[model samples]
Target: MIFAIVGPSGAGKDTLIRGALAARPDLRLVRRVITRPTESGGEDFDGVTPEEFARRQSLGHFALTWEAHGLSYGIPRDQITGPGDVIFNGSRAALPEAAQVFPGLRAILVTAPDILLAVRLAARGRETAQDIRSRLSRASFEMPAGIAFRTVINDASPEIGIARLLAALQPVRA
Candidate 1:
């Protein structure tokens, strides 16, 4: 199963996944190909230029792809190996498409109040006030009908969010 984690820019999706990994080494964290610079912190992804990303996408290297915040992100076709649950930092808009690729895909929607999201985004310093506002405005998304999913409110610490994710994944694991 591919467990795709989706949320707004500063919802701490990476932070929650980092904690979940520490607790469950059996779970795999799928690295993504992103247009962001490699030096940018948070999720560790293969950074590529727009040209390189386009070339790779054209070669059928990616199983899923999406654009957000003026950047492109992709999940390589090879990353969708069979069997165990593989976790990925994914976009909310692409969840249905990912589910189509991995039929047993489970979505974990990490979210927080708009106020909290704005604060967290500001703290990251990755985007300006205007950029953060734009993100916050489009924060909510309607999940594709019938896609197995659960929502986790990451309003507090990463530890709390991790616990919620683990609990949500328990039934799916069983």
Candidate 2:
């Protein structure tokens, strides 16, 4: 089974994934390739130039790809293959397509209140005030129909959020 971690920015998706991985070493993480510089620093992902990204996509190197916030993100086709359960940070808007690509794809929607989201985004220091507002505006996206999903409300501390994620993923563990 593959788990697609989807959520708005600043919802602590990366943090929860890290904590879950620490506790559940058997779960595999798919390192995504993005068109943003590596030093941008939020999640651990490979940064590639747009040309390189397009080239790889043309070569059929990606299992899935989507564009968001003016950046391109891709999950390598090879990474989705293996013996264990896999997980990747994915876009909420791409859930429908993801479900088609990987049958039995379970989505974990990490979320927080708008107020908390604003605070968290501001704290990141990576986006301008206007950019933060832009992100917050599109935060509340409805999950597409016909997809199996679980929600993790990351409204508390990081430890608590991670615990919630672990609990949600418990039943799916192999």
Candidate 3:
């Protein structure tokens, strides 16, 4: 099984994923290869330069790849294989393509209220105030019509978010 964990910037997707993984050790958390610096906090990922990322993609190293915020992100091909369930910090645009690759794929769309999302994005300190505003304006919570997904609102706390994610992933029994 493959589950795509997706949401707007600063929706606490990575934090929620980390907490859920701690409790459910059997689940596989797909490690992404991203162009962002490793020091930029959120999800733990394999950091690579844009050149390297393109090279890897050209070599067919990624099962899925998408570009956002002027950076390239890729999920390694091997990570999504095998019998056990795997979760990726996914992209909304790439979900359609991913669904084609993994038949039993489902999505977990993590979200927060606009105000909370703005605060969270600003708190990250990675993006400037203008950038944060631009993101908040562009990021929509509306999922594609007819796409099968579970929505998790990470508004209250990390614990609540983890519980929601765990419940959504109940199909992936460990």
Flag clash pairs in model 3: none
**What TM-score against the true fold does each predicted structure earn?**
0.94, 0.96, 0.94
Worst 10 residues of 2 by lDDT: 165-174
Candidate 1 residue lDDT tens string, 56-87: 99999999999988999999988778666789
**TM-score, structure 2 vs. true:** 0.96
Clashes of each: 0, 0, 0
Judged by whole-model lDDT over C-alpha atoms, candidate 2 comes out at 0.93
Local accuracy of candidate 3 as per-residue lDDT tens digits, 17-93? 99888988777999999998888877789998999999999999998898888999999999887766788899887
lDDT of each: 0.87, 0.93, 0.87
- Which predicted model would earn the best TM-score? 2
RMSD of 2: 1.7
Task: Give the runs in model 3 whose Cα sits over 4 Å from its true position.
Answer: 172-174
Global lDDT for candidate 3? Answer: 0.87
lDDT of 1: 0.87
Give the Cα error of residue 138 in candidate 2, in Å: 0.9
- Top-scoring candidate (lDDT): 2
